[model samples]
Target: MKVLLLICVLALTACTKESEELRMRVQQSIPVPATMSQVLNRGILYPTAGIQVTGVVRVVQLSSGKQLQIDSFSITPGPDLKVYLSQNALPGNHLNLGNLISNNGHQAYNIPANTNLSAYNYVLIHCQQFNHLFSYGKLQ
Candidate 1:
């Protein structure tokens, strides 16, 4: 009986450690006024390679400025994941929006005022440390 209890405790500890490593929090929360913000373009994310992602990404025009909003998002968690506005499916010549706030839930990132929205046709979720493209959505 004592041995069984010890094994259960060990299993619980391993699960806790894994969850801690995968957990991520919002880095920035940019609020867009609901009445003033307009969604200029929107797209549904498609996973790249084997990575999994589900969400809708939106290019929002706000009275204060422009921003990228990810709504109802969930992704396979990984290290150094970042958000980018790119000219293609890849990251070359892309605008680094910022680190993704979390692997799940709604989040927003401010886009620089000088960025020409027309120049970017896709939104990318990338892993900087590993140079992996996790997912992307074509703005339409």
Candidate 2:
């Protein structure tokens, strides 16, 4: 009986350690805006432009009717790009290139269903002039 109890305790301890390690990895990889103007203007000799996050996204709720959110991230190009989100991996649910704004760095939409509340995963981000993609994991 004592041997069985000891084995069970050891198994539980191992599980706890594994969980802690996973949490650390998730926290370390939260995606922020990537500065890519130099790559965008490699050939041109024009003045350098700045890219910034224009809008703030505190929390994006995903419910039945609230499936999509059109977050605007504008660039100096004078066009506002729209980012779309869906609940599933269907035609309209994934993130792509055409939705990204040229100069603005928006935190893209968060699809609640696709996100893992327990762990971090990648989400789709889109823009117009550039179809840039990024990853963001679950936050505590």
Candidate 3:
């Protein structure tokens, strides 16, 4: 029994170490037209329990449409992470912007032209597989 417990502990530690080293880096700089040089709303991201998140999130007006931009962003690596534009800080009643591109970097998600920013004003990083809220930022 002692040997089995030791094995379990070792396995858990190995898994944690592996996850820490596996960071997916991404960069997506969406170009805004020179004429449309406006940031309609912006906010700072805050981490949730057991997570570390740092970033400036903003809504930029574009010639084509609006975009949710994350700059100088980094987050604790997790499986099945997704980007969401939510009505609340929590996950319910949200727009699934799609899978998070990376654990760290500048990334952008296009906001549908029809989306009402006043209603869905909170940006969230969620773990869809586990239904976990990793971080959130409310646009003001």
Each prediction's RMSD over C-alphas, in Å, is 6.7, 18.8, 6.2
Per-residue error (Å), model 3, residue 58: 0.2
Q: Pick the TM-score winner.
A: 1
Which residue pairs show backbone clashes in model 2?
75-103, 97-131, 98-127, 99-126, 99-127, 99-128, 100-126, 100-127, 100-128, 120-138
TM-score winner, 1 or 2: 1
Best by lDDT: 1
Score each candidate by Cα lDDT: 0.87, 0.34, 0.85
Tens digits of per-residue lDDT for model 1, 30-128: 443353578999899999878889999999988778989998899999899999999998999899988888899888888999999999999999999
Output candidate 3 Cα RMSD: 6.2
Candidate 3 clashes between residue pairs 3 or more apart in a chain or in different chains: none
Model 2, position 79: C-alpha lDDT score: 44
lDDT of 2 by residue, 51-129 (tens): 3233322233333311222224333343434443323322244443234423444432333455432222122233334
For candidate 3, give the lDDT of residue 41: 94
List, residue by residue over 1-140, the lDDT tens digit for candidate 3.
99999999998887433342243322224332233448999999999999999998998888788888888899999899999999999998999988887788887788889988889889999999999999999999
For each candidate, give its TM-score against the true structure.
0.76, 0.25, 0.75
Superposed model 3: Cα runs more than 4 Å off = 1-36
Which of the predicted structures, 1 or 3, would earn the higher lDDT when compared with the native?
A: 1
- Model 3 is weakest, by summed lDDT over 10 consecutive residues, at 24-33
Error of 1 at 96 (Å): 0.2
Ranking by lDDT: 1, 3, 2
